[model samples]
Target: MTSTTPRYLRPGKGTKVANAFARGVTKLGISLWGSRVLGVRGRTSGQLREVPVNLLTHEGAQYLVAARGETQWVRNLRAAGEGQLRLGRRVEKFGYRELADDEKPAVLRAYLARWKFEVGVFFDGVDASSPDETLRRIAPGYPVFEIRTA
Candidate 1:
């Protein structure tokens, strides 16, 4: 049987447009549904850039993950390594770390289920594997971050 390839497997004009649109939509969605405000200091210069991201609970603590590691905001968060989180009217600074391999899948599943429909449109041509694989391939570049108490 011929293997069904990922859309990124065939990069063309349509793929380019879809990818771009996905980024735009994701940014909008975060601004709307994301409940927490995050600020990342510029690693070298010490400037603060902030954005909203979906806050998640895993193992009874709060965390956030970049569905597509392509997000510049996530890059900024990484560069800073530590940041401030504001939920509702409260705020705190926290150290952040990328999650290990075994920790990623469950967090990914939670994220995809939270943002189901948008993911479908954004990640066109991905095979809907089990509910499990759907989450994994929903965003190949998924990167998870855990927040440490200040």
Candidate 2:
């Protein structure tokens, strides 16, 4: 298995605080601009791990973009193949398929359009208006997953 740890694997203190806040908001049924709490089983421990994720909707489909790059939640989602998206007491079970690097540009673009102000730093300056070539070039660094409702 290729290590999902990206070069920018370590999240700063602010990131942690923001994530905690987002998760709390999600638990209260108030999505912070489409943010959701993702729960996936850890590959090694078989324990559910939760994290705050921005749920992106594009072309009538739902997607999950790993803004921090190949993160632990991304790895766990890959291993589990399925997970739950929670908001308040509402939990939706879903499966996901990882998008190919070449197929990520559109989804990435949409994600950037919605979250650029929050996550643009991680994209190395790429944004919604960026050309496909630019998004594709940086695609490998960010993992995009298509969510399939169960």
Candidate 3:
């Protein structure tokens, strides 16, 4: 298979609150471990929809891991293929390529290693030290994208 469709996990009340707080801080230009407000065009409405996301840098490349699985922003990103990562006055326009399941293991490892404390629960017990096979096993449930800033 080329890629697995990620399973969506709706954010709980606490997660929603935290995301909101993070977005607020990020809007003021304060990033929490690479946190940024992601904005994508709505597929149907053609209006901008925003969400808070962790931007991971691994092997000198950047990625966005859908730790909450195939969320609205993920779906939107797939359709729009480009969007912005915002931090207050700074707006970074970016393009993305969704990574296949086989390409996700390493990126997943790095992402888990960096933000596990915040996002671990959504990973279904997988940790940074998990073996390649283990990571691959869970890769399908999480979608990853390599991103480039312009």
Candidate 4:
């Protein structure tokens, strides 16, 4: 029997290796294409968990898109409602508001535009150049969150 997990949402071995590298390098004060160490408390354990994430800016707002669909950080962030973005020695704590599917296309487009080479695979065949209709159609599969700073 096949696993119920969607193919796009599953991180393969290479993705895992790359994420590990990104996390380690970013924590060491180096950023790869503006990657940040996202620290959010675990929903069940209450311990802070981190993964290097691409920080996207669009229309003067900061966003974090879950190109890999609903993963651990997405669940934890949803439960915690706030998290930290760390780059180098600096850490900024912020709250997040999950955007509706209708609100996701623009940010997702911007995110895809910037890091398509790295994350395009997760978006299936859609890309920054994809039509708005296509983006909206796939919007629900990708979760977009707006970062709110205090």
* Candidate 1 vs candidate 2, lDDT winner: 2
Candidate 1 lDDT score at position 94: 89
In model 3, what is the error at residue 40, expressed in angstroms?
Answer: 0.3
Per-residue C-alpha lDDT of model 1 across residues 4-121, encoded as one tens digit per residue: 5422233358656754554344444433354566778766668886655667776677678764454656667777678887654466788877877566667766655666554444
Q: Give the top-scoring candidate (lDDT).
A: 3
- Global CA lDDT of candidate 4, please? 0.90
Candidate 3 lDDT (Cα, 0 to 1):
0.91
Ranking by TM-score: 3, 2, 4, 1
Model 3 worst lDDT run, 10 consecutive residues: 1-10
Worst 10 residues of 1 by lDDT: 2-11
> What is the Cα root-mean-square deviation between model 3 and the actual structure?
2.6
Clashing pairs in 4: none
- Candidate 2 per-residue lDDT, tens place, 115-145, comes to 8899888887788999999988889888899
For this target, which candidate reaches the highest TM-score against the unseen true structure?
3
Q: Please, what is the whole-model Cα lDDT of each candidate in the order they appear?
A: 0.62, 0.90, 0.91, 0.90
Q: How many pairs collide in each candidate, listed in order?
A: 0, 0, 0, 0
Task: Estimate candidate 2's alpha-carbon lDDT, on a 0 to 1 scale.
Answer: 0.90
As for model 1, its CA RMSD to the true structure in angstroms is 7.1
lDDT per residue as tens, model 3, 10-99: 988988899899999999999999998999999999999999899998998989999888889988998998999998889999998889
TM-score of 2: 0.93
